[model samples]
Target: MNNRRLPSLTPEQCGSRILDAKCIVAFTGAGISTAAGIPDFRGPNGLYTTGKYNADKVFEIDYFHKHPEMFYEFSRDFIQILKKIQPTITHRFLARLESEDLLTGVITQNIDTLHHRAGSINIAEVHGSYWSASCLSCNQFIKNGATLDWWEEQMTQSPRSPVVLCPHCGGIIKPDVVFFGEPVRDLDKAETMIKSCDLLLVLGSSLTVYPAALLPQLTSASTIVVNQGDVMISFRQDMYFILSDLDAFFKKVIDFIDS
Candidate 1:
C-alpha cells in the first residue's frame, strides 16, 4: 500500500502536467496494442480467455521444446497480423513525443515491436520481440524480421509437423519472446529510467505481472496512467488515472500540448 494520498486531477490539469513535464518515461503493455487489432491476454476476447489457445503451453519453454508446432502455430498467426496492423494514434503520439525530445524512452512489456514501428527510437522491450531469434543447439541467429514469413511458409507446406530449422545445423529456431520461465530483458535499465524520470506515463497495463509490475513503485516521478480498463495501482499523490480509450485520450492530450 502507498502512504501518499493525492486527489484525482481533471483532464485539463492532467494535460497541462504532461505538457510541462520533461523526461517522460512511457511504460506500456499489451492493452496499448489492443486497438491495433491485437488481443490483450486477459481481455474478454483474448487468446487466453477465449481458450482458443493454451497460453501456458504455448509460451512455456519446456512445452515449446516438446511440441514446437503448437507455439509455431500461434506465432504464425501473430506474425501475420503484425504485418497488417499499423500503429495506433496513441503509439503515434508517443513517437511524436520522442521526436520532439519530450519523452525519454519507452519501457514496454509488448512483444509486437510496434513501438519501434511507430518510430520510437529509445525503447527497452522488457519482454523482448520478434525482431530476432536463435537456434538452441548451434546458437545460429536470425537478426532480421524475415523468419516469420519463412515459418509461415513451413507451416503451409507441412501443416502437421512444421518445424523452423536452423539452416546452419538443423536445430530448432526459437523467437526471442520471453517465455514464462525466462527472465525479462533490459529490466535493470528500464528501472533506472523509471526511478529517475520526472514523469512516468503508464499506458494500458494492468500492472499484475511480476517484476515489470513493480516498476511503478520504484519511481517517485509523477505518474499518469491511461487505459480502457481498471489499472492495478492504488491512488497516490503523484498518480493520476484516466480510464478511457487510449487513442482518444492521447489525441486530446496532443491537442492540449499543441495548444
Candidate 2:
C-alpha cells in the first residue's frame, strides 16, 4: 500500500459539491466499516495474522464443500464482531444523503449490512452478505440472523468436519456471500447505477477486486475518491482524490452538510 497522501479539498467544498449534485453514487469497501470495529480481512492484522485459512482455499466452492468447518470458524468471528458494532458516522452520513435525495444509490464491496441498517434505501451489494443463506439441495433461501447462530453451533460441535448437508435434500448449505469462484451479486443493477450517476463517490476501498472494482470506470460522472492510500485506476482530470481516514473526513463532511 502506498503511504503517500494526496491533496484534499476542504470539507465544506467537498460537502457542497456532493449536496449540489443531482445524482450521486457511492462505491464503498471495508475501510468504511473499520471505524465500527470490524477488521478488514485483507489487512495486515486481519486473517493473514493467523496464517491459517488461505483466502483462495477457504473461499473456493469446492474446498468449502469438503471443509465447511473452516468457513464456519471465520464466520463465527465475523458474526460476533458485527453484532457488537453499529454503523459509523460515515455510513450514517451516506444514508442521510440518500434520504435527502442527494445520492441516487450505493454500490458496496462490503458484505456487512451496515448501510441498510443505517436506513439507506437504495443499495447494490456487489458482494453478497452474511445476512442470508442458500440451500444447495432444495434451492431454498433463508434471511435471518438466527441462521448464522445455528451455523456457529454446528461448527463448534463438528470442527474439522463438513456439516453442509442441506436440510431438505441432504446436499449442501452455503452462506450467501460470494465465494472465490462465485459471480458477484447484482451486476446489471450496478452497471445501470454507474452509467446513470451524475457524481460518483468512492470511499475506503483499494479497488483491487475485479468486476466491482471496474464499476467506477463505467460512470461518466465526476469521481471523488476518499481513501487512505493509492488505488488502481486511470487518473482522470475530473477525479478528486482525498487520502485520509474515512471516518475523520466524513465527520467533517457531515458537519458541513449540517451547517
Candidate 3:
C-alpha cells in the first residue's frame, strides 16, 4: 500500500521512529474501531456506504431534533453492537504505549469509548462518547448525568425501542457525541497535546472531517498517517503514510518495540 505521491515506511521503521520520539500523541477514528465491530464512515462496509444507517439522519443535529427516533433506532443497534465487542489490538497498543509512558495521550474522533475500555487514562474524546448523556431539554442541567449502564438499559428497553429520556425532566436524552452541526468537544486539549508532541500518529482517520482533520496540519511534528484506504491529507517531508490494515500494522510495531 504505497502512495505514488510520497514515500511509505514499513511498520518496523514506524516503530523505530516512535521509540526515538519523547512525546507522542495518537489521533484515532472509526477505522481503528472497525475491528471491534464498529463501522467507519468512508469504508466500503462502513455506515455511510452501506444501505443501512442513514448518515444524514444519524449524525445531523437538526435531523435529530426533528425526528430523534431515527437517531435512536441507529443508536439502539450501535449500542447493541458495542456491548458485545472488545477493543481491538490497535486499541491495546495505544493503551500500552501510554502505560509505558512512551505515548502522551490519545485524541480520538470515535464516540465508541474503546480508548477508555482499553485503559488509556489521558484521552481527549474529540467527538464525545456514548459513555455519558445529558438532558437535552434542560441543557445539561443534571450535574452528574446517568451512568452508562442506566443509559444502555433505557435505550434497550423492550416493547418498542424508545428514545432514551432524562430521568429528572422526562426530556430527550442526548449522548455527548458531537453531531454534524455541533462543535467538537475537546479541541483545546487536543491541540495542546498535538502541538507539544514530537510525533503524531494518525490512525484509522480519513482526515476529511474538519477541524479534527485540521489538528494534524497545525503541528510541524513528524506525522504518520495509517489507514487501509485513501486519506484526504497530502504527503509532506516530515509526514509519512502507510496504507495498510490498522491492527496488522500495529502488531508489527508492538512486536518490534518488544524486540
Q: Order the numbered candidates by TM-score, best leading.
A: 3, 1, 2
* lDDT, residue 36, candidate 1: 92
* TM-scores, one per candidate: 0.86, 0.86, 0.86
What TM-score would candidate 3 get against the native? 0.86
lDDT (tens digit, per residue) of candidate 1 on 180-211: 88899889889888987899888988888878
Error of model 3, residue 113, in angstroms = 1.5
CA error at residue 172 for candidate 3, angstroms: 1.3
Q: Which residue runs of candidate 3 sit more than 4 Å off their true CA positions?
A: 1-4, 40-55, 141-148, 156-161
Which residue runs does candidate 1 get wrong by more than 4 Å? 1-6, 40-53, 144-161
Instruction: Please list the residue runs of candidate 2 whose C-alpha ends up more than 4 Å from where it truly belongs after superposition.
Output: 1-7, 42-45, 51-55, 144-167
All models, RMSD in angstroms: 3.1, 3.3, 3.1
lDDT of 2 by residue, 127-231 (tens): 987656788668887444534456566556655555545556766677788988888998899899989988899999889999889988897678888888787
Candidate with better lDDT, 2 vs 3: 3
TM-score of 1: 0.86
Candidate with more favorable, higher TM-score: 2 or 3? 3
Which candidate number has the best TM-score? 3
